[model samples]
Target: METDRKYLFTTRIPVRWGDMDFYGHVNNTVYFRFFEQARVEWIEGEGFRVGPDVPTGAVIINADCTFLLPVNYPATVLVKMYAGQPGRSSVMTWYELYVEGDERLYATGSSKVVWMDTRTGKSVPLPDTLRARFD
Candidate 1:
């Protein structure tokens, strides 16, 4: 968990059986999918457009996750998003994952989301609306 993080958004994703690896746990890579799903849902819920056609939007520069416990099937993952202080063009976003209705954290992760001009594929200043949320 990150201290001094601004609560941003959250979403729940059901874990599909196919998400499991041979070891019978959710694939390590699936954690990132959960993170991305939460991030996109929040961003869109905030009324920011995302996609190649958008003139300006978000891009992930990097992401990482720490698996604290195994996630099994027939579970819904609750992803709660938090944000670090905003910079000129980017913010550090954190996520805490738990099985819905469970107190134990399954994982924690973070990603750097940069505001960008999609056409140019270059970073842009954070949108005022986005920066306001971090404030």
Candidate 2:
């Protein structure tokens, strides 16, 4: 479903031959990887580091994907990210994937990310600076 989620960012990733499985198309599991790459790029683009280095970080609580079409190798995938309204400590993110140069949607997905204190592992209010990015 192409929901009207607010667009936030877009990135392009070239499909590798290794992404394909025995069925001769991209494996089902790799779609999450594609969604992840886009999410990471968007996070870093906003000038935040993901791993243990940060005092607070984002953790995805859940993720889901609906595959609509198969993607083959030798293509560059365009992953578009959108955001739902930001909450006190969490937000929902959506993704749309398509082969670059083509408008046809191949997959769509979403994940809920919670901002938490890295050390304590408890949810914390989102940073004001980062919160504006969602607007």
Candidate 3:
């Protein structure tokens, strides 16, 4: 059993020169991508893997975000990820973004991903190994 009551995953992503829009600060779209990297790495860190080999692969069915602060170039922001809920074949990941050296959260959001059979392209049950990691 993955007894990690609070699974915290963090990554320091260097704000790319191109990530900023004309208005400056990392574009709103980039934050979602940052959140995705955190979530994917979180799952990959576990022994469980996500790929075409699995009968079911995950797909983001829903996503939402709130920008509390602006992130600019030459900065490394921390993206935090954690499992929100795990059901039969779906899992929701909660995330928070914090600028380095700051204790305040810059953004918070959650995404719902559902497992689907790659071959059949239909929703399926969550693999036991992956499900076990959830609280």
Candidate 4:
């Protein structure tokens, strides 16, 4: 658990049998899905929706994850998400995965999402409302 940084949003996700690989550990790709879910939940929780009609939303430009420990099924994981460095048109979203109720870190991930205008399909600065939520 990274104590120095405060996470604005947290979610509990149950590991499904299908998330495991032949080695009985969660597949590496599943971590990305976990990160995506956490990001979407955080966005919605902040009173923002990502859709065609929304004037401003984000499009993920890059994503990366580092696996620290193997996770098995029948376990719930805690995903903590927060904003990292914010740029004029993009922001880095950070994520930490932990074993539920434990301080041990299972993985860490990040994604760079660029704000865009849905109608014009062009990059745009982060809306003041969204930026305030991150702050």
- Candidate achieving the largest TM-score: 1
> How many clashes show up in model 2?
0
Task: Give a tens-digit lDDT track for model 2, residues 1-135.
Answer: 335568989999999999999999999899999999999898888888988889998899999999999999989999999998899999899999999988999999999989999999999998888899877
lDDT of 3 by residue, 1-135 (tens): 123325558888878999999987899999999998887777677655677787657788999999888888878889988775578888777788998888988898878878788899888987787787674
Error of 3 at 101 (Å): 1.6
Ranking by TM-score: 1, 2, 4, 3
Regions of candidate 1 where Cα sits further than 4 Å from its true position: none
Tens-place lDDT per residue, model 1, 3-62, is 888998889899999999999999999999999999999999889977778899999999
Show model 4 residue runs off by greater than 4 Å: 1-6
Estimate TM-scores for all models: 0.96, 0.94, 0.86, 0.88
Clash counts per candidate, in order, are 0, 0, 0, 0
| lDDT of all predictions | 0.93, 0.91, 0.80, 0.86
| Tens-place lDDT digits, model 4, residues 46-70 | 7889678888798898999999999
| Reference-based lDDT, residue 88, model 4 | 86
Among all windows of 10 consecutive residues in model 4, the one with the lowest summed lDDT is 1-10
TM-score-best of 2 and 3? 2
| Ranking according to lDDT, highest score first | 1, 2, 4, 3
